[model samples]
Target: MTSLSPTTRTTLGRKRNRAASDRETLYAVLDEALICHLGVVHDGTPLVLPTGYGRDGDTLYLHGSTGAASLRTAAGELDVCVTVTLVDGIVYCRSLNNHSMNYRSAVIFGRARALTGRDEKMHGLRVLTDHLAPGSWEHSRGVNAKEFAAVSVLALDLSEASVKLRAEGPDDEPEDVAADAAWAGVLPIRTVFGEPEPSADLPSTWSVPEHVRTRVSEAAAQ
Candidate 1:
């Protein structure tokens, strides 16, 4: 994998206090995230939409209906932003103002262009499907030309991007710490997998696939 060099535009913050300058840290956060918020300007108005994305090397791929207004507007656009955030914990402080949540977020800015050609579209679709469910691509039916034509794919280059992370506990003043009237600590947050539900039409002998079973196991282990 090609490492992304941290540039002034890719720096974490203005003060660089909460910025995560390491390329590995940023890539890990993006890889672990499932959804991202896409920001675009339509007719001089700002709009943010939450959608699913997949990363391939230095580019991110987003898929949606060709008829969708937002996707249509974003195609061939020079101005766009994508953000992904993962909340890790809740910090409780003696004072309300000192309380803050621990989180990791990434912001990407670049031009987006619609992807054409059957080979690229098929590859994009596979990346998206596998990102959501690892090992699912081989198990499920591949996308046909008709289904591929109905969808639109936008590729965003990762030339300008930054990651910001806050993981410390609450910051309380000395006076507030002495008061100790309110609890001050961190409440860890996490994502978990529930029991798998089988489809109603499935045969009784059909068992859960290894991919899903492994996912549940890995989540539990984490």
Candidate 2:
């Protein structure tokens, strides 16, 4: 139950009861999520975009097209905010105002540095690729020089971060609980990976690989 030391900006302003100070919770939330919203201030205007990310220990990697202005600007000693959220269930309460969601979320604030060296860039790409499709990096084709040159990867250290989770049942008013008329409970939510469909151009005789098949089963079982 190691906890993260919260900074001024990382502190929650509202609903303090739901805040989670454990570092393990932050790591778990990030590892479980596929997409994260990246917020950056570009030219005095704030822009938030959903992007794929990967984590390696204390470093977070973000990749995108080299021509993307938002990412390009963010790489230049600019501060950014990255967030990942997972909804575990929907909470229904006796009153509409009390209705809420059971969720796990993490927010990270840091200045990102762009990777320029070939080795560093390749390693970053490997981390990102492996996170998205575990064994695909080793099984699939390698990145060519031209393709690698067209991509940009940014690395941010996870020093200032926070995790907040809400996993309790509905909290109804005392009077509502006495009445016991309204239905209240939690509806669980989950994301399951479906069977892999081969590309149309591929030969019909070709079968799915072991890694792909295993991932689908593992996701469903969870």
Best by TM-score: 2
Candidate 2 residue-wise lDDT, 137-170, digit = tens: 9899999999999787888898898988899999
Write model 1 residue lDDT over 109-216, tens digit each, in one string. Answer: 887777787788778877788788888898988777687777877778877787788899889999999988889999999988877899999999989999888888
Which TM-score value belongs to model 1?
Answer: 0.89
RMSD of 1: 2.6
Distance from true location, Cα of 51 in model 2, Å: 0.5
TM-score of each: 0.89, 0.94
